[model samples]
Structures are given as structure tokens and as C-alpha cells.
Target chain A: MKKWELKPAKDLGLPATERFRSLRRESGLVSTGMQLAWWSMVRGYMAVWHRLQITGKHHIPVQSPFIMVANHASHLDALVLASPLTWRLCDRIFLVAAGDVFFETPMVSAFAAGMLNALPLWRKKCGPRAMGQLRQRLLEEPCSYILFPEGSRSRDGQSTGFKPGLGMLVAETSVPVVPCYLDGSFEAMKPNQRLPRPRKIRLNIGEPVSFETVANQREGWVQIAETMERRVLELAPRRGA
Target chain B: MSPAARDRLFGFSHAFDNPVTLVVTLVVGSLLLLAPMLVWWLAWTGRIDRKMKSELITRYWSWLVITPLILGPILLGAAWTIVGIAILSLLCYREYARATGLFREKAVSAVVVLAIVLRSFAELDHWYRLFVALVPFTVGIIAIVAILRDKPEGYIQRVSLGVLGYVLFGSCLGHLGYLANDQNYRPILILIFLSVELNDIFAFIVGKLLGKRKLAPNTSPKKTVAGAVGALVLTTLLVMGLGSFVFRGTVLAGPGYLAFMGMLISILGQFGDLMLSSIKRDLGVKDMAATIPGHGGLLDRFDSIILVAPGVFHFINYFVGVGADQSVHIFTGG
Candidate 1:
């Protein structure tokens, strides 16, 4: 079945959220084995991230309808985020990814959309068009959006400041901007390394500061960003939910 | 000779020569051959996608057809066809490695070499004694030696750990040792191979037509109460009546025993298939390695062998009347 409605975690009940992502093109009519497989994948990835001890989850909206701004640490940041949030949120969360990166092949896109539920982000000069579409989705449906705060990935995997559009989107939505700092990913699969090591990583989620606060107070976003930076530093060493 | 007539006149070649071998091979080879057509028919009807369909045919059906054709009356090698299983186990392990990320890269070369070494020795005169001791001792030594190397950090541990999967996954191929050494090796192997395939076919045909009740939806969603009984009844009658002609004196101890054994083998085969499916479920993969068209991998294909082996092995052990400690005197039938 084709679904027109993009639902947020807040709108969906816990079980409903868990089941929702499993919906494919043949969503309702899939085989029993496939359905089992979908849910099992969702559960397994979440368990792995949870076992990695992602911290500051306590700071997230038990239900998220906010702008999640994090540094781009690795190619698999989407999956890493998916693995944890699929467990944490009570609803389906969407990540904004560069369209070209994942859309080259047909089956690949279908599968990513089906599994990751990722929405498109534009890296091209006219990226506003993609952001515009995202803006509409957020307004029409109660949705949480994950944004890579840094426009481009930091060469060294350090926490860099906001990309212009991310800050702009944060201002437009007035949603809480939760800064998440990730540690150990750069070392695990360094840019030069061909394969990833199974290294422990921490996702440091900070207390949500409203867009209004950052806009009204000069340097408030930076303070909020600093608070986030410090929080990730604190969260990195601890292995917990 | 033209290929079709050659296939026909040759009676499908080496794997199905003797009357005992022919009957068993007919049952086993045909079922193996038919499985993919059924999958294609299922796919043609839009049951599975193009990716799954192609995967099923190439990975499973191609090997299934080619193995029996190339190996011939050696259809008994259902447990381990030379080029087919050797490659199949490697593919199965590749899927395992990819899914589990257990072995990493460093472990791949060493573990694969050891596994193939074991395969090369599969047809040795003393395969059973060699396999039983060699697998245990060689794997242990390899693990210790690989671990001691310390080629890189995390490499050795992963290599050493890979031995578990290599052994657990590849050991089923060792059933060839038992198959070869059976005094009535050709018939017994073919008989059991066909019986399992028959169990699957009967269960599917009967289950589809009559199954209304769920047997174990959690483990095997397709099976049903009616299907189970139908398989039991069909296999006992069909297998026994056929076995009487093909197996001759060893057909069955009696109708009662044949029915009992047939029913047990059906259940065992079903359980084995389901067990492998469950492993895929746990590991979050589909079709072990996409090696076979309809079947998943060597592990997937031989899922029944591990369970079926004990039953057939014990039955042979008891009938051959070898005391528990005695080496099996493989009844070599030409």
C-alpha cells in the first residue's frame, strides 16, 4: 500500500511507531517472514546502539518534534542515528540526507526509503528547494528532523558550528535544537581506513534550547552550542542509555 | 550425442547408475531439479520479486541441476557435491561473515584455506576417521597458531573466533564421509536424500492443498496441522512402496517401521529447514548467501543433513549391528 501521510513519533503510539517503519510498497500485504525480518532488523540495530551506551537520551523529547543538529562524523552516521533513535523515540523520525549520495541506483533508494525512512536533503546550490519540501512536511505532520549542523563533514571529525540553512531552519520551525556530539567514530573507521573497527561510541545529546532563545539573545545559540559541546564531552565516557 | 538424448540415455549419469542408486537419485535429483521451477512458478505468479527470483534460480537451482548432472548417480553427495558444496559453504560463510562481521578481513584468508583443505580431503579413503579427528585437531591448532600470529590488533581474535563458524557451518559437509563409507552407500545416501526432498515436496503440495491449521507459525509460518499429517501419511506409503523396489532387502524393517521412520524423517527435515530459517531470522538476513536460486546456501540446502544424519546414522549403526565403538564398515555397492 502507498502511504501519503508521513507521521511523527509523537503521533504514533509505541507499538505503532515500531511497526510503522516496516511498511514497504507492499506494506500491509507482505509475507509473515518479511514482516518478522523488518521488525527484527529494527530491534537488532537499536539494541546494538543502546549497548553502545548512547548518553543524553534523557535530554531528548521522550517524543521528538525537534531539530537534531549533529556533526557529520562518518558515512554511516545515518544508520548510526537510525539504530539508536528507532529505539528511543516513540514515533518515526526522519533524517535529511543529501539526495545524490543515496539515490544513484533504483533498488538502493527504495530500500533506504523503506528502511531508513530518510527524507532528501540537497547539497546542490539550489538546496533551498529540498529544504522547502522538508519545511512543508514538518508543518503538515508533527515530525522530528535530524540535520547535520555542519554544512560539510569536518575533515578531523571535530564538532563544527552550524551550516547556514540548519540555523535558518531552526529559526523557522521554532523547534528545540538538540545538539548531539559523537565521539570515537573518527577513530573506529578513520577517513583513510577501508573498513570499520567495532569500537565503542557515545552519542552525546544535550538539553534542548528553543530557536527563540537563540534568536533573541546574541551569542545565545553559541552558548547553547557550547552547552551541547560540553554535554557531549560529558556523555562520551559514560556507557548508558 | 545431443544433450537431451545424452542426458536421457545416460540416465542422468554417474550419480544414478545402480537400481538402488537410480531410484534414490530419481527421487532426489528430480526433487532438487523441480524445486527452482516451483520457485519460478511462484515468482511468475508474483510471489517473490525479480531480485529474489534471479537469486533463487542462480544461487540454488543452477547448482542443484549442475551438481547432480556433473556428479551423477553420486546424487548421494546431496550432502556435499565437490565444486558445488565447496563453493556453497564458502558463500554461506561469506554471508555469515558479512552479517555477523565476525571474521573481519584478516580471518577470511586463513579460515577459507583451512575449510577448503578439509574439502580436498573429503574423498579420501578414510574420510570418516580423518574428518572426525582432523576437524577437531586441525581447527584447534589453526586457531592457536592464528591467534599467536598477532598480525594486527583485533585480527587474530577475529580469526580464532571464525573457526567456530567455519567448523559449525562446514562440518555438515563432512556427512559425505558417512555417505561414501555406507556399505550400501549409494542407495542409502540417495534414499535419505530423496526422502528429505520428498518430505519437503509432499509437505508443500499437501500443505498447500489441505492446510488450514497452523502447526508452528512462529518457527515455520507455512506449515500446518493438516499438512504435517498429510506429509506423514504420504511419505510412509509413497517412500515405503518405492523403497521396497529400490532398496530391495533394506527397503524397510517392516511397514510399521517404515511408516514410523518416514514420519520421523519428515518431521526432522521440516525442523531442520525451519531451524536454518530461524538462524537467518536471528542474524537478520534472508537466504543464507543468495548462492542458490530457491535454496539459500550450502548450509541452507543441507539444513536437514545435520538432523537427518543422526537418525540415518543411528539406524545404520543399529542395523549394521556395529557395537558403539566399532568403525562403520561402509557397505560399498558398485
Candidate 2:
């Protein structure tokens, strides 16, 4: 008889409160259902209200263990970037959200963890430990990530220099990092806006960038970040021309 | 629905009518009150270390909270009892799925959950045929759903795990809720729940004091042959003592019959615990989940009850039918 392959849940034994903030968090039926429902609603809202469109949709790979790094602009950037993927992928994709904002309170933490399926990145206290955990999860679970490498949302709709923190995840690994550009999400829902406006939004996915040759060090991370930033910026058309 | 059925379904007023319910309720209530005093005395006398004392206190507090939730529904009505069991079935299923990594198979898990809900409906409607039929029906559905994924590499593993999970948490545990179909379900249920829980306590205490010769060292290191025998004797006595009042007029009134039922409760209850132990041993986890403060998951606390529920239910069912005189198809009338 083949013995039962007993792989207990990765996030088992953690208390509920600890589960929300843990990097080892894994979605079960409830979180999967919630993410599906929430993402479906976001997809619908983007299609109707924002007139969302995606080019180079085929650029996003069908498999996981990849990072979807996009230019941070508005709150809608992550939603717009992640809303187009199939629900199967969406369930595994964790949006690396800011810990201070999304996870400060219990209610928001629940929404962020349950609906958005986000793993928090404590910018203030974010060190190698946090990044190492994220890196470990990406390789161990062989999961994908949707994160803004600029570290925070762009205030004036202009993409900034990509932070090296993104390197901490994909550097020295075979995991592909796909650079993406979000157009008009800033106009739709800026950082200060309480509600998003009905503005047409477009997503441009660039080719997958590999950092396998890049060293897993500070300099290599910076190189990976800069290359990804240049690629994402290249996806956006020149303004007014 | 008939007035009698309505009364049984929603009759909070008659909750205390049965002496078994009254005695069990009072006894459980008193235990809840007196446990803390015992803890404090032990702590005061410095009999237990701080860590052990803290763990015991935490366990007691959780019991204080859990006792009401378990009793409130039964006291309210059979309908509430069924609903409560449905919730428990769902929670237990969730814990099991997560532990076995079966929750990732969304389709099979969904079917399992759907089967559980449907069984709850059957119990509520008093539809015995559907309640009984759900087992094979769900197993077939889970098998089919597993194939829908189209990846056959680990197809057998996935389907079998789903089937086992549904059988353990969904079908087996659901029998406890179905017991509410009996007109005198409150006391019958109280009796079963009380004896099953006390059986665990007996085994634990006895095992601690007199336990030698590990029953199944690979499955459960702490369990002893001596403890198993002790629990069997004590639980059988407790059941016979308390069960006499509940089954006074039934065919199960005699000492011989009562003793048999008690022995079944004790033995089956221990087997249920061993079943979970085997699962945990295979999985190499201590507790199912850290849900309760001092205990493990709801599954850990209620693992023994899962098998005991069906065992006792069917045993009594064979003797004197459950809900024999009660109205059938209370909701979906033929």
C-alpha cells in the first residue's frame, strides 16, 4: 500500500492573528473563494468603470514561480495588474502590499489578507529577514508575486527608480520577473483619492526579465531593479506624441 | 409541519423537561465553575509548575467558552442543534483539509462541503433516505470532481484523501446532528456528548497514573493498554448509570444492553482517538491546529466523538430506531 503523503499545511498551527501577517500564509478554500469573488468584482468594475484594456497579455506566463513587477502609480495599479489573470493564478499570486497602510488595523488586515491575499512588506522594518522569507516562499511554494518595485505608489503619476527590494525576491533564481506598466490608473485613483474615477486604464506587459546571472547581493539587486525599471518604462508610450 | 414536529424543532420551553438534560446541564455547569477553584487550589499548594498551571487554566477557560456554544443550540431546539452541527462539520472539515493539504483541491473540497450541507438538510427535513444516500453519492461526486482536474499523476491520492476527509468529518460527524431527529434528542445527545467527553478524561487521567505498556507506540506514545482498559470500565459504568434514565422505557433499558452500549461508547471512542492519532502520526503534527488555547483544533477535541457518534447512533438505531415515531420529511413533504 502506498503510504499517505502527509504534507500538512505550510501555515498550520499559527493563530488566526499571526496567520494574517505571516509570510508563510497559504490560502485554503475560504480565502480562495474570497479572492475569487473579490477579484471577479474588481475585474468587472475595471472593465465597466475604468474601461480597462491589456496589451501583451500573452507575456504573462501560464505557470507560476514568477514575479510580476509593475510601476507603482495608484491604488488601482495592483488591482489592474492582477485582475486580468485567471482565478487559478490569482489565488496563488500574493500582492506584496505596504504593511503600514493595508495591515495597520484589524479590519483592513482582514480585507488585505483575506480578499486581496496580500503579504505585508513592513517598509520601515523591512530587512533581509523579511525579504529572505519572501524569497524562501517564492522558491519553496513555487508561487508567483505581484509587487510594485518602486516601494510605494507614485505621487504624480510618473514612475520612479525601482527599489532593490524586488531583487531580494528573484535574484540568482530561475524565476522570471515580468515588467509591467500601468497607464491611467493614476488618473483613475490617485493616492489621495477616496474613490476611483471612470478613466480608461491600460496595462502593457513587457517580456520576462531573468536575473539568474545576477549575484544575490546588494549590487546585483540594484542591477536587476534598474533593468526591470527601464523595461517597464519602455512599455509606456511617450506622453502627448 | 405537525405541531409535535414544530415543538420538537423549536421548543426551547421543553429543553429542561428531560431529567437527563437537567442533570447533565447542571453537572457541566458546576464543573465549569468548580474547575477554576481546583486550578487555584493546585496553584496555591504549589503542586503544579507555572507552565503546567497556565496550560490547565487556559484549557479550562476555553472549555468555559466552548460549553455554552455546544449546549445553547441543543437547548434552543433540534433545528439549532442541526445548524450547530453543520457549523461544526464545516470547521472540522476545514481543519482536516488544511492538515492533509486537500484544501488545495478546490473542486473536491467543494463537493465534500456541499455533501455536508446537503446531509444537514436531510437531517433537518428528516429525510432518512437522502441522509443515508449522501455517503456514496458524495464519494462518487468527489471522485468525478477529482478527474475534472485532468492531471492523473496523483489522481488516486487526491480522490482518496477527499473521500476519507468527507467520510470522517462530513458523514461520520453528521450522525451526531441527525440524532436530533429523535423527539427526545436533547437528553440523548447530552448523554452521548457527556459520556464521550468524560471517556476521554478517564483515559487521560488513568493513562497518566497507571499507564504502562504503550497501546500503539507508533500511533500514540502516551496511550497505554492499562489506560484503555480503565477508560472502558469507567465510561461503561458512567453510561450505564446515566443511560438508564435516558433509555428507561426503550428496549435498551436492561443492564446487559446498557453495558453493551457503554462498552461500545468507550471502545469506539478510544478507537476514534486512535484514528486521529494515526492520522497525526502519519502527518507528523502535534495538534491539528492551534485553534483552542490549551487544546488543539476542534478536530483534536472532537476526534473521538466523530466515530463514537456514528457507533452509538447505529447501535441504538438498530435496537430502537432513531426518530421512529417522529414525522418524516418535515420540510419537503411527499
DockQ of each: 0.02, 0.75
What are the per-residue Cα lDDT tens digits for candidate 1 across B1-334? 2333223222224454557766554655686768877988989899899988777667674666645653453453433333444554555555555445453233343555465566535432324555566566656666665656556565444555466556645665445444453434555555677677677778888889989998878767888888777877887786576556544565355676566667767777777877777766765555554444455455666676556755665665565421233233222211
lDDT tens digits by residue: candidate 2, B120-141: 9999999999999999999899
Candidate 2 segments whose C-alpha is farther than 4 A from its true place = A1-4
Best by TM-score: 2
Candidate 1 Cα outliers beyond 4 Å, as residue runs:
A1-241, B1-17, B23-85, B105-109, B112-116, B119-123, B138-167, B250-257, B294-300, B321-334
Worst 10 residues of 1 chain B by lDDT: B325-334
Predicted candidate 2, C-alpha RMSD: 1.5
Native contact share for candidate 2: 0.88
Q: Model 1 — TM-score against the truth?
A: 0.46
User: In candidate 2, what are the lDDT values of residues A25-137, reduced to their tens digit?
Assistant: 88888889888999999999999999898999888889888899888889888899887688779777999999999988888988999999999999999999999999998
| Candidate 2 DockQ vs. native | 0.75
